[model samples]
Target chain A: MSATLVPVDEAPAPGASRTKPRLAAWIGYAGITAVLLLFAFGSPFFLTASNIATILTQASVFGIAGVGLAIVIIAGGDDVLNGGIDLSTGAVAGLAGTVTALAAAAGTPGMVAVLYGVLVATAIGVVNGLSVTLGLRPLLATLATMGVAASLELVFSQNLKIAVTGGFFEAARGSVLFGIPLVAWLMALIGAAVWWVYGKTSWGVNSYAVGQNPTAAQVAGLDPRRYRLASYVLSSALAGLAGTLLVARLSAAVPGIGTQILLDIILVAYMSMIFSRRRLVSVVGTVLAAVFVAALDNGLTLLGVASQWVGAAKGLLILLVLASVTLRGRKNR
Target chain B: MSTIETLAAPVEPSPGPVAAYSGKKRGTLQASRLVAPGTLALILIVFSVLSPVIFTVGNLFGILGQVALLALAAIGLTLVVRAGGIDLSIGVALDLGALASAWLIHDGYRAWVAVAGGLLCALAVGAVNALLIVILRIPAFLATLSVWFAGTSVQQLLTGGGAPIYLSAPLVPDGFAVIGRGYFLGIDAAIVNAVSISLVVALLLGITRYGRKLTMAGEQPSAARISGLRTNALIASAYLLCAVIAGFAGVVLAARSNGYVPGSGQAYLMDAIGAVFIGATISRYGRVSVGGTLIGVVIFGLLDNGLNLIGLSFFWQDLARGLVLLSILLAAVVLGRAKSRPATGIFALLRTTKHQALTNTAKGNRK
Candidate 1:
């Protein structure tokens, strides 16, 4: 496909050196520190240990989803035209949550309910993979799935919130390991595993190759199509996991719960690009970015700002990062 | 026969043997052209059978109005897509326009002034998008997405935390009423607006030099820039025009609803995108066209109205719409591939002996 020939924005040229990436990483760290310090000074509650843990817990759901989005953006690329994005992430999450909640309500075991949710999401992911491999644009294909999933969420949940309690739900919400929620620990472990795989494994390297230049990857004896499809499947599966976790945390499967966090997932994933070496989206970067975003949200909420306004603040921050990167690129050119 | 001839004719003139080859290819071209209209006709027939009220004058007019409002946004989206960019913030422009106008009217401003203010607000968003994309070099998708996020917050702030600003009949100016409720020459004003806007956009894209330049800039930016075309200006203008047009749709929506409902314009975003892409199937090269968008809008409007009339719940309607869109997209892909390579996969197995012979003959003639 002609799309395979399109170079992703984050794909550094062959033989590019490491110095610039180091400098970029430093800049990203500095930015994060600056924000944290600002919040610390802005509100007394922001620096409290309990508030910090609260932020981590709040970050866990979308943070895990952000990891999946980061993988897709890294492997399949983030370009809107030729590259791909999974618009169905939030919708899939929402559907997964509804399915899991419904299953639990029907007296299914917790593990079984979770399996049903993730499996259903994985099935949708397969459809997305089929569509993209069949030559449909990823944006539009995922958009179709998003609509379908959202509709199903509404249909299955009957447009009402489904309360889920006891067993796994309560455990997921209440259990803390070392002063942090279990879900937060799960997020960290997933982040660490993904980081290791992406940084040290051949599969990760091959996926990056596919995103950087699919034609070259094919020439290198890699099946770019398979890799791209796998990335999407992985993304949707993680979204499903995140959805289940979110429902557990909320103790309810709210109709549109997944979509409500979509903006945050995208923001965190894209924000991670800034922290990644050479601006390539990385799992470690995504995890940190997620925490950073959660802190910002938490701080703003404490400062009496509405959630939607915090969303606006995040949007503006992303624009700033984009503008800075563009300026930097121009200067280098 | 003439319609078929026009549809079947090659886009560019060819000589001698090539003309004969094109004549053979004409069959496939004609079939491709028929797909959208044929689908529309099938939908019309099915829906009319399903709901007797579908054919009623009032319901037909209602469908027309709905189509008009949707077309206004889809057409604007078509322009941006044609310019090689996607504007995710089209809904933002729309909502801002609606909110600005409605707020102005609520504050006792003249309806005309309020409408202009709304348009200007939308245009400002376009200007910002242009600055982000053209100057800062951000991708259109992310740039407009941020705008959409920020714009939603702006709307919330203006509406006092997302409350709808209702305009009572007594407070509604005659100009506003005419815009929403008035008829002209036995046609609803909204339909008139849609038709005229469609005509003007068609002329702009089809007949104007600027439009041609914009299309070229979108299709081949580097080539256009090398040819001394101001690609940047053209692109910027495209975004600006897109915002203003979407803003106009927002105005109409506000008038129709007699209030500025926060995020109401967002309801059109996905549908408008679906319509534009569905319309792309009509073009030989998959270029977006104003005429095609109108057709898409009509199809969507009919489906929405028909599904409502069928007494399907809202969730069912959403599912149906999504499935229909997916099917259309998949069908377009499958049919396009089959036309190009008839001896492929399941399609090859499905072909009858007579059809196979015909395709082979066509291939031989092309060769």
Candidate 2:
């Protein structure tokens, strides 16, 4: 049950931080701002306080999910296992949300519902971890889980949206600081916790160790299996947490909720390589990229463009990042 | 003995412990061939018993149509899977091509031109995927997955927020629908196409030098490189072939449906993957053979149609497919290990299980 320690981010431009031009770095962040500025100026209402708040609020769910995915991605350092990505992340989230909503609808207490949801999500992680460690190919394993989980959601919710009202939903949607929803703060807290673990603690070090070199980690007396297993657990827990919050925001839980969000979260993680100065998978990178994508979508919508075009924008943006990352990789190589 | 030899003929020659694999052959009954066909029959018998009122000859032929589309993509996917690479975007690439071609037919273009346009988009996608993997040095899985997401977005943009595009009967030539819907020689055209594709791809992979090199490079790039093979080019061609064929699958789908729906092609991904893997269980060398994949597709096609006959809910159908895929994957792993891990052998007796383990290592290194 040892994790195969292949550096996930090693496929990208490994020397991205060193090879990238200073001005390009500026452009990455500034371009996002420029997009924001264009929308603000071109569309008068975009600069309004309410519009800005709306964009941030919209980004919160993605922000939370992106951080979780980033954990799995960043867990590997030199010999990264980019294969550790959870394609079923969204489906697990949807399932968790559906279960939570179902419980709430069935007159279950709020804490019980939330607990039930979190447990289901965590179980998905444990399953994914088990499959990977226990001999199934990670990609196929997750894909299987994805299909099963999505269908299970349909089974759980009986192919119907489960709507609920409860104190938990209120806390999920209510604003505590700066008029932002509690979910946004939750995202920040989760991101901060992950960042702390990743940068400061032995868990982070062991994860990187396991990803980069399992044999060495084992020699150093660390169980790469535990860190690898824990990585998926932490990631899915956050996804479940976000999905629960999403149920509150949308005021209903659907079987297919994570279908789109999962893709967006992965995109957020991958795009982090470009948006971040370091080009490594990190909590800061994931959160910023989530906001960046959310902002881009918001800007386009504000400019009166149809939502479909935003999809095209995302595709083109990924290609741009990929191309840039390749260029940097070649320069360094 | 002839049957045993035929069954054992397709095993991968380059890897796996010969002693272990051949040990199963000593029984005069190969495991892979027995189990795959056995499972398909089991499913048929059990499901048919459960829903005798629904199973019929006509229904089986109708199910062939469903098998056709999945087989086409699965065959294309076999090109990459054989090379130890993957094309995660094939499903979406099919949709992209379908939407593009359907858009053309929606305009004033000839049906053939529109189909060509769709294939062109698929080729473009494949080339981009190849560039990412070969040049950027990205893993085939991630490279293809990224493009898959991007491809979905592209489809959304083309449809303008997931709108459906239609090609009416009068909108294109009469032969347009014939590709997918028309019957040829007392069989569905889609089935004809799938069979023809399987034959051609099988011949090239089994008989051609390029195909051998592809398998070689895919199995062991360092070995292939040392042998003077252009491993990158070989890998690149696999990606290209996968995309181009998938593009054609998209064309056929468009013809059958008379247009494109934003996410119509996504459903095929699971079955296509299932077909390829299931093919491994039936292959001569435990390798992915086009013929084996074709069989795999038929099994899946039947399962899908049979489940429909049984009146399973759509979610249950998905659940069934997922469960089936996991079982197939698990079976392959178990069967492969049993074959590769000898209970005892002439060479195997002296060889540690650790030494024999690498036989399967370089073969299924999808991760």
**Candidate No. with top lDDT:** 1
On a 0 to 100 scale, what is the lDDT of residue A187 in model 1?
A: 95
Worst 10 residues of 2 chain B by lDDT: B1-10
DockQ for all candidate structures vs. native: 0.22, 0.18
Model 1 lDDT tens row, A178-268:
8887888999999999887766777877777666545445555788678778888988999999999989988999998776788889888
lDDT of 2 by residue, A1-333 (tens): 112321222233334334545555555677667777888888888867777676676777788877777776654331122235777788888988998999899999887897899899999888877665544555566677888888889988888888889777876666657766566677778778887877677677667555543434455577756776677788888888878878888889976877878878877877777765444566777787877888888889878987666776776677667666556544433
Per-residue lDDT for B45-89 in model 1, tens only?
999999898999998988998778789999999899888788989
- Relative to the unseen true structure, what is the Cα RMSD of model 1? 9.2
In the range B1-367, model 2's lDDT, one tens digit per residue, is: 1111122121222223433444543443345345667778888898889887546777777887768888899999888988877788898778878988888888878878888899999899999999998877775766776787777777876666788987767766776788878888889998898889889999999999988999988756655776789988999999989988998999999888898998778778777877786776665455778987887888877777777777887777667777776666555555545654453321121122222233233322322
Candidate 2, position A317, lDDT: 75
Off by over 4 Å in 1: A1-16, A20-25, B1-34, B341-367
